[model samples]
Target: MARSARPVVHYMATRPDGTVPPTCNHLARYYSGLGETIPTVNLADHIGETVDHPSPGEKWYTDKPFSYFHMYTRPGEILERLEVEERWPVRLWEVEPLGETGNWGNDFAPYWLMSHQIRVVREVEAWRAFGHRGMQVLATLAQLPDLARQWTEEWTADPEGTRRTYTAWEKRVDHTRALTGWAFCRAQYSRREAGLQAANELAGNAAAQAATAAGADPHAVALIQLRARCLVAGQLMFDRIRTGEYEQSIRGLLLGAGLETPAPALA
Candidate 1:
């Protein structure tokens, strides 16, 4: 009959200078649970974003979310086919698998568009590509501006008669956005924790069974899984932080609201 369509992927980038980021190809690929399918690219390898194939003329410096997609087919199948054809057993597991054109290269794309800043498109197709869950699952992150507005209206409704108080609408609004963004990051990492745990269990099958059979702190495995997830998720968050796209907007909104958005805790 018909085959399932592989979910579109959203990859995040990691920069050489070393900065905290909220999104990146690495994060997108890992987060998308599809595993060993989607590809990733470093910021250095990226020439720039293109809209018209050859990139038009100047090759706008804008960063666009990217990933390969067939008209109507699952991406996972394509990847599986490649793995067998290329016979890339051990190498396939590497974060960056190679095989373009002849061997079938891992397609890469941006998760979001950025010209002067980050653009939010809820309808974008690849939302679920990177794992089944991400910051996108968080409800408030959908619209930072509106969320900020609503938060401000309720937070300081009865501030001192002086309009110069810290409770100004601008401050409240900015605070909400920052808080929302932070919350999103927190949830995004949780998914990684789950993924890492699964991977480790698969790796240490014997340890898992022994632990399971002995009944020696069944909860011990939970912490191990969480630590691994956090480590990887932390890196993903830091990569997005480097982009400064989401963070910049929050800061700008906070500035307008007279609130200070605390720096992202990338560490």
Candidate 2:
């Protein structure tokens, strides 16, 4: 019998920086020097749009969305294979994992990508895991426009009352694109919250019972778990900062939006 394809993980390869992102050799070849132009037509392509006749070259088409299809190896499989091969062995659970080619020297691609802007497509349940942390997922959408402006001057060239000029058309197009991303982000954000809440309640109850059985203070036990979680998460953020992925991602986002070069980080 034929085997089904491995589940793909999705991520935005374009960083806020204009330079090529450091990733696996395969994905690097796929998206190097790539620029994503603001999509003109909606994905459905059924809805009609106002036309301002922008040049074709002005709109760049990137295959970043499609590149996920080519990815086949998962973190577990990559780690197992690498360990057996005795090349760049890494603890699957300890090291951050990103989806990438299962080759030596590129072992760090997945972790770096995950730290910067990678998203796993499979293991849909993982969203629940993040929710327990009480993370504000909606903030990414909330910050898009500000990110755009920080990246590009042309992002705000046209006000609502501006005539049907090229600049105005571009602004309108960007607004629509931003709205689409916002909608998707909002849905995921809601799902993550609901999932996190449910998962935490279940775990908290279990922890409380276990603690009570051991004649321990259940409340104190729960508090300790929460404290430990915060510390671990904070450490991960610190690691991202130290590795420069945090700054690189911010720059990549700015570039992807076609706003301008060298966007400033939010203080």
Candidate 3:
């Protein structure tokens, strides 16, 4: 549905502890007139396209959108699922840098996303009209595992299970795999703080090469910041095997990766 060219009011999602008066009777008032499930892109072009694959000849620069896209599956099909909300939810990835990598921001615009879904609603009416246009938008959101699996299958010149593993590093890394593993470990283990810290440290090291470097980009800073914020993910993991706080996850990684879990301090 073409927006009436009228102004629109958008709101940041409601927070965990914040409260908002539910006075806005029509929560979906903006999209009231528009069709449901508006396809922001060309639908016919995406037909028969693998929602999990990328378009050929289309180069993705390691910028915002494309960079964000690589961490998961094909962006085109993702938009399709998004049009229908069929996407499997997964952890959010950090925005990739532009410069020498690729100019993904202009084309992909991944930073605009919230969660696995492109969350900004286009007014209920807009969706209503979108629905009218023969768009088959599913209202349900995709599950996390579905999205995570898509991430686990990242494309690369690296050998099998090399880039696929939870360890081996990449400049702009896949955040979901580490995050999923961390979430699982945290849930299974009794040490909440220990797990979160270790997981964060792992994520930090994977995201960037430095921690306190003064000339880091936002892409790099985000990782450095994550490392600092989470306290000690690598340390926690290291401490555990060394002192046995909870050795299952570490031991699992050791055996799983075929790489010894460094009982020594985490790098």
Candidate 4:
């Protein structure tokens, strides 16, 4: 017996709200490099082409073809709906399997597994930018304790005027940390003396632990921590893009870093 001819269909994933996610767009660009441009189509418009129109509950299938690249936005929620709503066992009789499908963006290693020439360089550049910004924020956070100590010494020398200055400085640090999601050592001390003492202790403890963890130079340990934080932030940004929240993710990062959100470039 011979295998049935694979269907020539192309499937793309969309957000739960029926909007196309950036990941799908990036993947489509990747496919375009292969010489075939897959145009977006509504299942309602393409009724009776090869498959019946998807039901109301299957709104996730809007503009979707019968390929492996399914479920781009909020995949976790969609998969849960599939299991609970009894929407699984979907028809794939005339569908063609092109590439590894399912939830993407948990890890970026798979994206780079393909040939370098055809790899999506834009995604890579985006990831690099995310990671670099994350590192800069983390590096500043790590120095907060030291800055607190310096402020404390200055306060002791000139308690009257330095009190006002120190309070303003603390507020700025708190604001920065809150924006960047790094509010581990928030300024909760009502009195300057108490805040300074707490900050010094916290700083010393953090330095000791970092040194012990790496068992090397403290500078090297700091770099390693910065790199790890950047990688995690990049991974999270990718996941957000997969879920069709590219603007929110990118804009939040820019705002957190005290940067202006640039106008969208002409397409």
User: Among these predicted structures, which one has the highest TM-score?
Assistant: 4
Please write out the lDDT profile of model 1 over residues 1-267, one tens digit for every residue.
899988543222222221112222444445566544333232333223221122111223213223321111221111221212121111111012122211122343212222211111112222222233333322212333243333234323522322233334334443554433542354334333222222223323333343334343434333222222222333223334334676645433322323333223234
**TM-scores of the candidates in the order shown:** 0.20, 0.19, 0.20, 0.22
lDDT of 1 at 146: 40
Which is the better candidate, 1 or 3, if ranked by lDDT?
Answer: 1
What C-alpha root-mean-square deviation, in Å, does candidate 3 show against the real structure? 21.4
The C-alpha lDDT values of all candidates are 0.29, 0.28, 0.28, 0.30
Question: Candidate 2: minimum summed lDDT over ten consecutive residues — where?
Answer: 87-96
> Please, what are the lDDT tens digits per residue for candidate 2 over residues 59-131?
1222232221112223212221111122121111112233332222354434222221122222222221233
Instruction: Point out where model 2 deviates above 4 Å.
Output: 1-191, 225-267
lDDT of 3 by residue, 1-267 (tens): 865765422212111222111112233233344543211222123223322212112344222221122221212122122211111221112122222223346445331322211222221221121112101211111122232223322312222443223233322123333334553364234223322433333334433433223344454345333323222333333333433533544433422322212222335
Q: For each candidate, C-alpha RMSD in Å?
A: 20.5, 24.4, 21.4, 21.1
- The alpha-carbon lDDT assigned to residue 91 of candidate 4 equals 20
Better of 2 and 3 by TM-score: 3
- For all candidates, the clash counts are 35, 12, 32, 1
Best by lDDT: 4
